[model samples]
Target: MNLSLDYAIEMDQKDPLKSYRDLFHIPKDKFGNDLIYFCGNSLGLQPKTTKSYIEQELKDWAELGVEGHIEAKNPWLPYHEFLTESMAKVVGAKPIEVVTMNTLTANLHFMMVSFYQPNKKRYKIVIESDAFPSDKYAVESQLRHHGYDDKEGLILWKPRKGEELLRYEDLEQIMQDQGNEIALIMIGGVNYYTGQYFDLKRITELGHKHGCKVGFDCAHGGGNVPLNLHNSGADFAIWCSYKYLNSGPGSLSGCFVHERYAYDKNLNRFTGWWSHNKETRFNMRHDFDVLPGAEGWQLSNPPILSLAAIRASLDIFNEAGMDALRDKSIKLTGYFEYLMNGLGDDVVRIITPSNPKERGCQLSIQVKNANKELHDKLTDSGVITDWREPDVIRCAPVPLYNTFQDVYLMVERLKGLL
Candidate 1:
């Protein structure tokens, strides 16, 4: 079957979500044409409105000084609060259960410190074999910090032999074998390399049934997928806003502590002044009064500029609800797969889950006989995609801004490269 590039472009022209493509500042090549940007899974293209939101914060900082905390157009003291309701809506979480806080890894450690209560009997943590590097490092460091050998405390739930994806049954089998000795199950909500979105509700239920705490490193899942973290009953979760959230590089990340854990004072946590009771915080009392919800996890004042970028992004998210965004995402990414598969297995293979419900926006393609050279060729040809080590290129067509034509054009470039 001939893959007609013009047909894909025509599909883009008729796409209902096509107008969103203009919302982002798509990158230009040396020739100044918009490059095919399929790297939203890495760093999303910045929103065109980001400048104005940042400008507002910068102007307020210039004019108000410390007074900006109280008197600025958007008061810095409660700026994060402004984001709560909308961000909660985007992630299928309750407002009190979520907070925009520290970086992803930092928040992961903080949450683990509170949730991963490894005792003498149950001192193990189970994680996916292909978990992100930072998450593995954080979990390993936590084990060492608690005086447990990583080999003893860390249990990896791996894929089957000669397989690229992990099955839920594999996780169930591990739980049956070691659940009695496991204290926590920390898995990436979406596998970073394979783009597999786990069945969070099922995983959470399995973990709880086995008397284990469940948490998620949602860096790849957060905005890219509709994660009902609250309803899924995940004890805790962390996600960065820079990727699908489109909040700029190194932007503030988010943390979620289920509403069930909100007022559980018996629950352990590493607290700070920001987590102190806001009502009497200004009074400067000696009592370690903690906030009622996830805000109780805050350690320091968040950078307003970073939060400003988040606000800009969340505003866009609020306008384009997660359900609508996800609907578009399935169709767009399916188109990407359809186009890539058209090239046939002799050239490329998609490792990401075939079922759209089982994955998000990313399609991890393993180019046969292709090293970094083929990836570089695609980059040089103006198709921007990410190469994960060994041999996989990840391309995410974000529903918020990526059009069907972007996916179509990207495949055409790869066909040319081959």
Candidate 2:
């Protein structure tokens, strides 16, 4: 735990997941040196196997043409099915409860359609004040579409004055005061800005107790944290595969609908041929025999190439295991925090929770009087990190591909800049 380069090197040498770094194609500087990548929270580095995964599909298309749907190596006809169990495992859901389709916000809207059933009396929706912009936009749009004033129908679970993290007590108070008027509670499992991971089960229990449906946007939590979606008992959850999941940028997303709603065919949803019973999907004149569970949420066939990349990443996740990844994440992020604290609070202060259980790998650092110039300098110095507006710099040391040394060198470079 000492703040020394030697200590970081020793930790890397002993890291159980160290070999995973080589499995990913880390970006390089102009000199071809590996750039210290800490932006995995925004976009994950590509897996080495992703090339072959896509290549296999390309080859199949070249040989089989239109017949690739049935003749492809992965069989494009049911390509999304191939990723079911693995994707389900990644989010800790049953296969029947999970599916990979559409993009993140799109899937969020779909889930809202089914879960955010609001009446005039209970029409407001609850979200964290710092919810991701896309989620905010989607929820606002949903409120408007439902003939409710967005400003009036949207309830914000805000942090106390000058606080960076949201408190459960505040949420409990919100439920106590206005739970009757709240129809849905959609929270980000891991807040994108502050790197705070909320308790899904607790939130779900609280919402259900208030006679409101609950869901989560797990974009930041999905692969980075141990999200037991099934056990969390949330009505639904959605996540993109691009970040900690290590799929390509803007790749497909995964959806989780709790088992309780699996057989509820009467639940209103937007559907297409893909949601029909697979056996009867080709029957041109058949009635809509909706497929059971999460598959029923599908509106169209998935893009196989994207799913190929997802499959490659999920294969690695399955091999490394979430439990092992989470263990390394705690140690790795703890070390990052240790180094940041060693840098002295005069220069930089981490806004993320001190407790490892309350956050993921990302540490949002509030650099005193720092601006975009500092971030640009870090980039030019061969460190890749992301900058939020005002004063915060977000750095994520991904457990699958990042190392303790990466964290150390990054901090060292940051200290030098200071």
Candidate 3:
């Protein structure tokens, strides 16, 4: 790949997805120049239509009051259903297997309540050693809740010495040794720090071979890659909408329960009013006739404004399609990786997988002889990327709105910083 600015501009000119960049509001510097944004892994840029999406709901609420539940355009009662089909498409699942609901950690706990059934003979849980702190905390609490010692009951799958990415063989060895004693296997679909995308189907099959339930926290994988959750055959999975989904901060999370459990009335779960049957939902006090599939996990009615923001973003995804997005992302990040390689192995080291299939659009860069001040300087220079703990700069070039020129400029800025 050419490192010249003209080459980058030429690549952008010939791009099929160049028009998508104008769909979002890109941030600008004090001088009014657009900033090279690389932090979509932390929080995605707002889509141009998000404002109108929320304003429509506000307009309906102001004019129709309680009548907005039924009379308003898009109707508030089944607002989440509006997002189901598109969201399912992003994560590669059937509509009946997916639903938009609570926050990431909350949904993780709710899923554990149903899937983490432990017994004296098999009561341990396995997760990556470097999982997001919230997932670690949630699993620890689940262990204690079931009267097991947190540290004793929780098993970690660690990388070998001098390695950053996890090997599938190491995990297989863990299952080989402790499969009979483990009741659950929960893993991050993508490692947030290293941008390593795990093989969900392989992990699920290995867990199932040992009679263990499997699940994934797809907070980093959602919209960033083709998860194919249904094909993975995981018992359940959850992901947030704020990051790659670009649904605004703290938007509702998506939950996926495999079709095999869709109509399992005997399954143990924590249910609420929102999970009841739509036919008898407003008929006052009655027995809880739970809705089928992932909808049966909802605890309360959702906030429509957030759902509106999600709907706006998902509409864009529906138009662009995940297959198209994945194709562009492979090229975008491949270019980023190529440029970073030109910086010399001594100057900066890339920890993310070189194999495009093993990662998404993110590349975790580690600069030699650098500290947090270096990152601050990059921000001052109008480039935005995040610094993870220990040593690594996490930058995701989102395919939906990011361009070839943006990736080129970001690398040029990093070269200057070095």
Estimate, for each residue in 187-305, the C-alpha lDDT of model 3 and write its tens digit. 99999989999999999999999999999999999999999999999999999999999999888899999999999988999988999999999995888899999999998999999
Which 10-residue span in candidate 1 carries the lowest summed lDDT? 1-10
Model 2, 32-137: lDDT tens digits are 9999999999999999999999999999999999899997877998999899998888889999999999999999999999998889899999999989999999
Summing lDDT over every window of 10 consecutive residues in candidate 2, give the lowest-scoring window. 70-79
Residue-by-residue lDDT tens digits, candidate 1, 1-418: 2367677777777777678777889999998998888898989889999999999989998998999999999999988999999888877899999999989999999998899988889989999998999989999999999989998899999999999999989999999999999999999999999999998989999999999999999899888899998889999989999999999999989999999878987778998888988888788766888898899999888899999999888988888888888998998888889888989988899999999999999999999987999999999999899999999999999998887778877887888889
Question: What is candidate 2's local distance difference test score?
Answer: 0.95
Which regions in candidate 2 have their CA more than 4 angstroms from the true location?
A: none
lDDT of each: 0.90, 0.95, 0.94
Rank candidates, lDDT, best first: 2, 3, 1
What is the lDDT, from 0 to 100, of the residue 237 in candidate 1?
89
Model 3: weakest 10-residue lDDT segment is: 1-10
